[model samples]
Target: MDTHFIAFVLRALAVRLHTNRDFLSWYEHTKPDFILCTNFLGGSVIASIAKRANLKVPIFVYAADVFNNPKAGYCSKIDRLFIPTELGVKNLLSQGYTKEQVRLSPFPLQPSIQQMEKLSKSEARKLLGLEDCFTLLLNLGGEGIGSTALVKQLIKNKLAWQVVVVGNLSEASKQRFHALAKQLPGMSMHTPGFVSNIGHFMLACDVQAGKAGANALMESLSLGRPFLINELLHAARNTQTFFLEYQVGWVIRQPKQQMITLKAFAEDKTRQQRIEYNLKALPLQFDSDQFVNLLLNEVKSLAD
Candidate 1:
């Protein structure tokens, strides 16, 4: 979208590719209007590339997460830093970045409001071949870890529930989960690997158990699925706080604690009801469109 929008603004724009060997030479020859870098690439690499190019083009950095430790080495080279939330902006200020250099930019989804349709729970379950019972969707991100063992233990305990594991799994992990699925006769366990229809699966289940990635959290909220955040490393506690503040999910303190919580949720109907109430109260709407617009405007301002 950014590339297409830029093309729309500029007439007779010629795009070129520059290899590492000829990057400086190409930059000197072309002298492009502006340089925009996404946060995933980090500020250091962008700064180095711009300095080596020896071009006066304005450099803009878009940070998707909170900048807890912002130092001069990272901030000095960036002309402007685009952040996702007001919390991010405050974090930047604490790191000594001037207000002028910081801009609020949120993440955007490809699908618009019209595409935000949801399937009924029964319809979604039927489509996915899930049994008509209490189901839990366990998503361990791209790397499917702790799934095989977790499902096996859940089944061994003879819990009246369905376990569905989603995401990419290694060959060994796949075999293990498959064996467990076969062992548990009445307990229907399914492992549909690397599926694009995540929304369907999310809507089919009563609750979600997974890591606290921002994208995953937002998707769960958008689908109105109550999530159980797995225990994370100490460094990632701040990131987990975002979900806690919104009351969309509960955080597990450890692997054993996760199992205890799940067991309790399954047994205690009152606790489950309270959790469902909190999940319904969470805000479904996100400011992704506003973020995209701010980013586009900032890019245009820099280009002008």
Candidate 2:
């Protein structure tokens, strides 16, 4: 069978499975008045099901991608689309979506991050058993992609700083970090994979170096720390722009230039203070219920 045909068949099977009798029965029993879908194609299927049932449910989509281009037919079924930033809104507008169709909302945040108590740098360092020195946090999300290479560069350059590596690190990466810590007494390194108190870790570090993920960027902003981007995923390009526009972070354009950039950033106290000043000037911390309230108001308006 042709690869595309096989993929089409599997997708059809999955959709059919999703709208099976049992699933339909459960969905009907729930009697949902409003629907919010995060997946583009999935939202289309859900909208069709609601239409078939003659339910007057309002369908909304929360898209995180910087460039979102759902088929016009699929978008027609959606009542409203929510995006996290103005850049996302611009992307949708350029794709021919009406301004009324796209509304900007705060990026959804983790519950732990929202409820986390603010910690002073000294307090956070004490809690994490980190030394009072220049600290760098290398986090590239749970998969730990592109992390080992950055760590290798940092080690090769021998920039003596407290380095903490987080996320789902492979055993090989852990061993490498351990070996380096032993070999170089001046360089401090700790790899605690998948920490629950990641907000604290972010607090304890001077700069966050990793992928330009929305969640990480938001957390770094709330914590008033500059994010150093080493890897730029295509999906997070807009997030990188956001950081640059706000002057709250630095970007390492080339992998080999990581050390030189870090060295410069470390030496530039004026730049550090400027970023901190900008962070303080911006409104970052919000009550956890803000997003929840936004949803409730939207749903209530539909009901009215």
Candidate 3:
């Protein structure tokens, strides 16, 4: 039988499994051999229910954060704890999690990013209605962190390049940038709101200026863009180190630093080319088939 994933609404799930009899009824109806949760709350709660009901089902959890957050008290109850990077493993180990319980796994990417067809930068820009100007992608991620002033600074100073600043799930943010796009004709500017095709945008842009985040970091690498991640977000250090060590990207904390880096990048084609070559050469192993097989193997092992 083909393996499929199921979602449980936490509120309804809690009420349904409030008693052992209720849990048994639910389990019998579903016949699940185990559970795998993406975050701490769901995993912790599920583990508790299984234990209380004397259910021997394995609980697997993929902690999304690069640094181990102490709130994930459910690690003790989990049969397997998957961490994304070696740095993550070190963090978890330092917190006294047993080596046997932890497994190194790839950072989970959205299906859209994983399945996106490779497109040339020009083709991507054309699709997005951008002109031939040097394209810069300004994303503050889904929650719209550090959106306002950073964008204004870029628009004011970056007169040479075309910048696409996305509001990313914030209407107020979208309106704010959209207003700037009208006013800043000197620098070709586009303000889009909460784009679903962000991976494509990453592909289209020559450079990325955003938070040092997992999705942004990975998407930039996946597309070979020069990532200009914020140095202040300490949670992203693991990926930052990997990129810096591999000579793929940089962390910039200030607007002045952004200009200095971009100026250097513009003048240094050899350096940029080298970084691109290194990026393409990295063993990403991001194929959908391979990831599906990996998940299936993990599930099968638990079943056995």
By TM-score, is 2 or 3 better? 2
Q: Model 2 segments beyond 4 Å from truth?
A: 1-25, 65-74, 282-287
Clashing pairs in 2: none
| Candidates ranked by lDDT | 2, 3, 1
Arranged by TM-score, best first: 2, 3, 1
C-alpha root-mean-square deviation, each candidate: 8.1, 4.1, 6.6
| Comparison by lDDT, 1 against 2, better one | 2
TM-score of each: 0.73, 0.84, 0.78
Task: Pull out the clashing pairs in model 1.
Answer: 106-291
lDDT of 2 by residue, 1-304 (tens): 3233443444445346756455468677997777888776556566655555567888788774533434432444456777766767777677556876777776666778777888888889999899988898988587876546665666777777888989888888788777877755588888997899899999999888888776787777777888888777665666666666788887776756877777887889997898889988753433447766777788888789
Give the number of the best model, judged by lDDT. Answer: 2
**Which runs of model 3 end up more than 4 angstroms from their true locations?**
1-29, 66-74, 155-158, 169-175, 178-185, 231-237
- Per-candidate local distance difference test: 0.64, 0.72, 0.68
Selected candidate, larger TM-score, 1 vs 2 = 2
